[model samples]
Target chain A: MLKRVHFPASLLPYLLVAPQVFITLVFFIWPASQAVYQSLLVQDAFGLSTEFVWFENFEYLWGNQQYRDTFGRTIFFSVAVAFLSMSFALILAGFADRVIRGSTVYRTLLIWPYAVAPVLAGALWLFMFNPTLGIIPFILDAFGRDWNHYLNGGEAMFLVIIAAAWKQVAYNFLFYLAAMQSIPRSIIEAAAIDGAGPVRRFVTVIFPLISPTTFFLLVVNAVYAFFETFGIIHAVTQGGPANATTTLVYKVYNDGFIGLDLGGSAAQSVILMILVIAMTVVQFRFIEKRVQY
Target chain B: MVEKRPGFTIVAHIVLIFGVALVALPVWITFVGASHDGARMLQAPIPMWPGDQFFENLRQTFFGRGLDGSRTAPVWMMMFNSLVMAMMIAVGKIAISLLSAFAIVYFKFPFRMGFFWLIFITLMLPVEVRILPTFEVVADLGMLNSYWGLTVPLIASATATFMFRQVFLTIPDEMLESARIDGAGPMRFFWDILLPLSRTNIAALFVILFIYGWNQYLWPLLITTDPDMMTIVVSIKQMLEASEQTPQWNIIMMTALLAMVPPIFVVIAMQKLFVKGLTETDK
Candidate 1:
């Protein structure tokens, strides 16, 4: 091992990072610990009265039927959204890589939605799905199909997934496109010269090379699906139509910020943190090795 | 790169066009929707033409009064908030990431690998996981409802630092050796050498971090209850939830579209930098 010695230059780097370090400790670590502490005691909405209850909040949260249902619903929503979005993004990215002459136009346009803030993205879709004024139902009605996101739970979930997926496709596309572009053209041409068809070449050569991107995106998208979709869900569904659209993070936001159940919200957050950490560990241990670059 | 087959090429064009259409559809909707007045908006198959009412809609979104009869805050106010917040986050994040990257890659340190993983772990947490704890931290420090609550917590993260470190590591050590032989101090060497060469990564990180900060919703929503302090994103959320009886679809669409302009402009304007930045990493 190289014996580590501090470089005088190192102080500059540490100084640069100092604000972040302070902020993270103050905002991230301290709040996380505070949440655990707050969880042991119940507090009123005014945030004034406090009563200590050992694991009482956790027990109440776990035992409640609504919490369990919301928990299951959240998992279902996360898994479904992640898989569906990534699958569509992957297929579209693969197809986009092959056909277009001026592909940069497509690339640039495709990534535009990602630039839209999630709040605006959600509003765009919600406006389309709006029962009274939205053009989506009108467009569907023209095709001999009637649609209402507000009335139908399944339709609402589908719209939520589509909304999430639409914003995300560009992100996945960027990674896939970058990876595909990196594959040596000569190597792909050599495979093509062997008379392998497009599908066959993609499956045998291109897919394996881009598998790293696929895996990385998988982890990235899954984490996104898990934690970040709260805004979309909140803006569009509000866990509506009998709590069908509720996800874990949304539920955390609801319970903590809205319901004023600080203890329960904190418990949910702790559990969520644990779940994320576990998934991350699994990715590093099992999946990261498969990434090519 | 594949051999051109005319028949296959036709099919590929169709697919590419279809993908572009799907991606572009929402943006087109936003543009048109922002133009139409509320009555026209409710009409089926929404008026395909851009309306002159775009100005009227814009007039209302910023200057029109709310149901409580308060004058609507200027669109520039929202833009300014976003601009200030995004700039703060970008400056803080870039400074932090670059310095951290420099320290890890260029300097000798004890427990370097351990620190690397500690930062790396943050990449997985995302803001969503740590938000609750993060919120509490702000509240505990009496920073809630302040700009620091919005700006400070966002500064720390592992992604950009990790990325920059990876890029910096690829720089040949001989350059640093030469600089050192010239009696340049470590600080001077970094400022004189590493900063210039790392421009591409810096540009890329700028776009990514700017977008990240600009797109933030839940944190700002949670921390700042004051409408004055509320970001454009949270403002849009509030507008979307406002009652149906008095709903102003035109202004809502306009505000939403208004929020989108800066980030899109940033991305388009910086497209070259974005591509160059990422491609350099693969080398």
Candidate 2:
């Protein structure tokens, strides 16, 4: 990784890396190890006694109906989010890639949501979907349909997914557009000359060619929906309507902080950490494979 | 330019326009919501067009107590807190990452790879997963309700460091040798040569990280229990929770606008750099 002509081994490099190393140890490594350790020890509700029970927390999570439901719900949430946002972005990117003129303007208009914080995005969506006074509900009322994310569990999941997916569309779109643009024009030109229509070419040529970007975005978006959308879940529903929207990450925060259930929360945290590690490994492995393409 | 298919081009434009409009609709509604008076906002079928109370809402949100019942720090104070937190995080991450990446690429340090892998571990352990213990550590250190608590724990960024490392690796080794030939120390070369060369990258990364820092939700929410120390982003949660009774749509929408505006401005104004930064860091 280093240059051939590197500086000799010295104390200066130690000083240079000290800050990052220190922070990593203190904030990241320590907390992570503590989570693992805490997961093994269950404390009484009164915070009176602690006992080391090996894998009991994990077993408890596996057996608990709500935790299991949250796990399934999280996978469903990520899949739905990844599918919705990616397809939408891919469609927009597919179209945007065709327009020779005003593509930059289109991109500028489309990607500003990337800068919006997820909580605020949640707030905005919550505002729009507010049952009594929201504009969307008003529109839905005219259509003879009800829309309120608050009291309905399915609707709560749907709303959070939309907000989470909404913010992610910009990121996916940028990547998809970049990936689309990087394809050599001659291939598309030859396909067009061979009488492949735009849809046909996109399906047969562009889509497969950009599978690497698609995969990358999939992993990125899944990790995003898993961890980063905590704000959206927290602000929008608080894992509400009886924990219908409780992702694993949100459950960790809720159990630990709000519910004050340390063992359960730490166990959930450890599970989420394992999931992250797996996702990171998968990302790196796929990234290595993508380099071959 | 693949082929001049007029029908397809028309269709493409329509799709893009529709997509843009869909993406822009929420912000447009929020903007409209922020413009009307409180009573108007409370009414059903809130006006789709902007009303004339924009400055009045802005005045109330910015200068006065933010909402009716919530005793929050003034909107400007929270925005300033967000600004300070964002700047610190961006600057802090860039500074330390530049140092560590420089050391890893330029110096033959012992455990160089060890340090690199150690930093990489942080990527897998996000604050959400380790919230309780991290919060306990911060509380044990008495950093809660402080700027350091808000910014520092979250600043150990593996992505930024890796990006800089990649940037440094692309630089010719001859630059380093030539600087050594001139008898300049490593820090001097870093300050005078490397910093200037990577200025654009630094700026690009700044745009991305600034948004990241500004948009932090859970950490700031957990750490800054004191309302005075709350970030604008975190304050939205507070406003939403507190306003469960007699919700003030106008003021809350205004605050959401306040929270999103600066970062949105950065992304749009620095669109090129933002794109560059995003592609590089994530890769």
Candidate 3:
């Protein structure tokens, strides 16, 4: 990746990379190694000493019903969030791609929510669903279906999913729209000439063509709902209503910081690290494929 | 667009309009909710239009005492903390990324790829995944409750460095050669040539990183237990906690509004650069 006529080796280059390397070492690399090493070390009952018990925390977590439920719940939450946000964004981008007029205006209006922090999104959604004074419950009462996320686990999960998905729609929409814009106009025109309807053309041509973006957004959204939705889960649910909304990231925080189960928390952290590494590998592989063409 | 179908165009327009409305609805609700007084918000039939108590709520949020029992920082002070944290994170990330990218692209050195891979690995290790150890590290360093504590650990950006490396590689090699023939030093060449060329990239990355830094929640939430160190975003959670004791919807919504406005304004104002930075950095 380096240039051909680059400068010769010197201490200046070493000095230049020193700051980033030092920060990365102190913050990322060191902490990650700690998570891995500590994952294998179990503390004694007195909370004074630790024993090097490899993989016991992970095995205990695997056998624990609550941890297994949290793992399943996190998968469900991430998939629901990814599906909802991506589909909504795709529909909007498909429509926006059709209109020549004021598309930029629509993009501007649609994408500002991306700037709203996840926690703030949770706050806004929580206010509107505040049960006693909330507008959503008021409307649901008119429909004869009760809505109280505070007591209902399913409803709490639903609330976190909606808030998390709503924040992600703008990001997904921008990518889908950009992918759509980059597609050649003549391909669509050719499909129209072949007697294909608009929806059929999109199904057969446009959607397949943008599968790269779809796949990329899939990994990105999964990474987001896995880790970044910590804010949403923290603010709105606190992984509450009987722990229905505790994703892996939230669990890592809850167990590590609040629970003080060091080995268990570190095991969870190592698991999450493996997850991130897997996702990153998939992403880089996809990028490599894209670069080849 | 392929055919002159006005019906299809109208439907597209309708769908886009509805999508836009759906996206904007929560924000509009927040705005309306913020404008009303606390009692008005707690009652039924929250007003559809803006309320007359906007300035009152703003004043109360900025200068009022604690809401009933719980202590909270003044809204202005929390936002200022957020501002300071955000600026430091954005500038720090760009500065470190630029120097590292310049070195990687323009120089041949020992352990170059080793250092590059090390920086690149930070992308996979988000603070959420390793919260305990990182917090322990920060606490051990006695950096808790400070701006350095808030921003420093979050500043090692793999994406920014990668993006800048890509940018520098695209620049002609002749520039460096000519600068060298003119007796320009490495730092001088970097300062005079590379910085000017990558100005837009730096600005674009600033927009993105500023938002990234501003929106941080879990990091600041755990580290800054002190009231004075609370950021605006984190303060929303505290305000919500206080709402259990005293339901001040007006002030809470106003603070949420205040917490979110600056980043939203940056995105809107720098829409082009934001789009460019986002697509490039993610790629």
For every model in order, the TM-score on chain A comes to 0.86, 0.98, 0.97
For model 3 chain B, the run of ten residues with the poorest summed lDDT: B63-72
Cα deviation of A108, candidate 3, in Å: 0.2
In model 1, state the lDDT of residue B276: 61
Q: What TM-score, computed on C-alpha atoms, does each candidate reach? A: 0.90, 0.99, 0.98
Steric clash pairs (candidate 2): none
Highest DockQ: which candidate? 2
Candidate with the larger DockQ of 1 and 3: 3
Instruction: Estimate, for each residue in B1-283, the C-alpha lDDT of model 1 and write its tens digit.
Output: 4776788877777887887887777777888888987878766677766888888788777665432322335666767788888988987888877876777776665556665666776655566765666776678878877777788888876767767777776777778777878988777877898899988778787886787788899888888876677678777777777735566677778888888888888888898766664443322
Ranking by TM-score: 2, 3, 1
Best candidate, lDDT: 2
**DockQ of each candidate's interface versus the true one?**
0.53, 0.88, 0.86
Give DockQ: model 2.
0.88
Candidate 1, residue A5: the lDDT equals 30
For model 3, the local distance difference test gives 0.91
lDDT of 3 by residue, B190-220 (tens): 9999999999999999999999999999899
Docking class of 2: high
lDDT of 1 by residue, A1-293 (tens): 11133355445656655565655566666666776687788887687889899898889988999989887877777677667767767777777788657678778877666687766778888888777667788777879877877778888888888788778887778778878877888878999889898999989998998877777777677777777788888888888867778888888888776787888887888788788888777666654365544
TM-scores, chain B, all models: 0.89, 0.98, 0.98
